[model samples]
Target chain A: MRLVLLIFSFCDWLQRTPVASYMRASFWAFPLVESLHILCGNVPLLVATSILSARLAGWGLREVPVSKLARGLLPWAWTGFLIQVITGLLLFSSAAAKYASTRIFPLKMLLILLAGTNALIFMRTTYRRVAAWDTAEVPPLGARFAGVVSLLLWSSVLVMGRVLNSAVSLVVAAHLWFAR
Target chain B: MPDFLSWCQWLESTPMSATLRDSLWLFPAIETVHLFGIVALVGSTSILDLRLMGFTLAGTPVPKLARRVLPWAWLGFGIQAATGFFLFAAEASRVYLNPAFRFKMLMLVAAGLNALLFHVMTSRSAAQWEGRSTTPMSAKIAGLSSLALWFAIVIAGRMIAYFE
Candidate 1:
């Protein structure tokens, strides 16, 4: 597995992003909304990073606790997710007809799945108890664990998103270069 | 700019990146890891920053909160530095030629330097910071800059695909 991954990276590394090949610069909506998608997707990312980083540093959620902040931030994060999913789909639609065959596409979907499933688990199991944490004062093994997992999963998703996009861009550029 | 395209073609044809590109999935995988680190860096620091900026928790020492999140942020930076270069190496001249790419690199430098200034000039004293958590002006400036820079980087990164 490591060997295969290494080979792929090497190939990918050799391939440039071809950053300017097919850009029409004519469309407004696609670029506008893609900007939004990228922005919004970052919301959950920021919150999750904070909660988890707090844990990694031994602060746990006790200082802020979990239930309140999680609940408060949940809507914003979900809003971001919704934007990402919707806009992400549109962005994909712009290129979808051929993106299906790429390896990075599968990786992107899998990372999203990992993040979503893990997030669901977080919302369902540990978050329910967040309200009771400050007063109840539990040691936070569960929330800590959840936060750590959230960080790891989200991070993977972020990387996958980038790699997927980069690889896809490379493929598109290659196609254009060849067609030219 | 035809010269630039020729340069990219030449760069891609070279045995160095070709061998590495064909041989190293480690680059992407580490990049994957770096993404996680970056999210953590943003997430961890923002939580504290938000608190300092009057968003999340109230009444905690600002310095203490900063202390807690700071290490994680640094760790995130470390991971980012490692994998970020590989992402660049995959296509340096390509990114190097784009305006958006240049801006992103500038933002990266600005963000890093801003972070340093915040720590050096504006960090709250240990006494005022740890318990009642009042963020110094410099820290807030750093946080806002950091936020803007990272977001810009992400946008530019995404825009790299769309750039002409």
Candidate 2:
């Protein structure tokens, strides 16, 4: 109850921010920034994840050391994530109330949380043992499972993000129809 | 040009396009799949491009890296080509008129050409540079050019959604 209130208040606060309002009102700026967000944020992370996931599944670039590959790519993923968070927040703030109310929105967040958690667990456990299978073509079962989950979760996130607008419109239309 | 626009308009009016546009969920749903295609295509391509640029992943041979990622890249391209056509069919005339769409098409051509040329020229001599972190001048330039062009395409793609 208290926690839910705090969350709602935080969302309200975010919605009221100047950046949020600006994003909502500006036509060109919104789209341009959204494009930048995808380029700088999602693209890199997708690239890193695809490669890492592929490597983990023992499919691609079998010759490269897994630890080295992770080291090389994960930084780009982190950088993309940071950019994504900022851009995503700005986009969300543009219609915080609608987003906050949407079922898909929470689902999207949950999927993201799950993806992050999976990555964390993998890093702490299977990844810590990465040195053992650094040169092996196929990673251990745990690592492979993490890879598969990461791909599915992130892909679902992309799907959810895209459909969010339509979902909102549908909800609004339903409410208006019922009210009438 | 007017005929072409009419043709596009006709395409947009088709049952398929109508269904896509009219459904509350369909257009955005296709768009979501389109995005996944973009990720797969661009993500896979970038892996090879990065290897060419010698940015990272030096331990792996260049040819090997290319071999591994290119298939997925091709798969991504196929998905994008299909999904993109569907999206375009739904809004054909409008996209035809959109400067962003035009720019995106141009960039797509450029990116394709870059890849073709790299395969023909720079990648022909990949054997010499396989194990090394840094590629030859031509390969490096090809890689860098590809990255820039693809990034431009993504920017242009995003712009299309807004400008149209």
Q: Which candidate is the best by DockQ?
A: 2
Candidate 2's residue-wise lDDT over B109-139, tens digit each?
Answer: 9999999988988555777766677677888
Please name the candidate that would achieve the greatest TM-score relative to the true structure: 2
Q: Could you tell me the lDDT of residue A53 within candidate 2?
A: 91
For model 2, the TM-score of its B chain against the native B chain is: 0.94
Instruction: Please give the distance, in angstroms, between residue B145's alpha carbon in candidate 1 and its true position after superposition.
Output: 2.9
Report the lDDT tens digits of candidate 2 across residue range A1-180: 898788788889988898988997887767777776777788898778877998998878798899988888899999988998988888888878788888899899999999999999999999998879999898999988998999888888877888786777677678889999
The TM-score, computed over Cα atoms with residue i paired to residue i, of candidate 2 is 0.87
lDDT of 1 by residue, B1-164 (tens): 36766676677667765654775465567555655665666666666657756655566566766776788778877877767665666676776787877887888888778767766764445555655545656666666767777777767765664676
| Backbone Cα, N, C clashes tallied per candidate | 25, 0
Candidate 1 lDDT by residue in tens digits, A20-80: 2222233555666666665566656456455544543356655554555555666767776
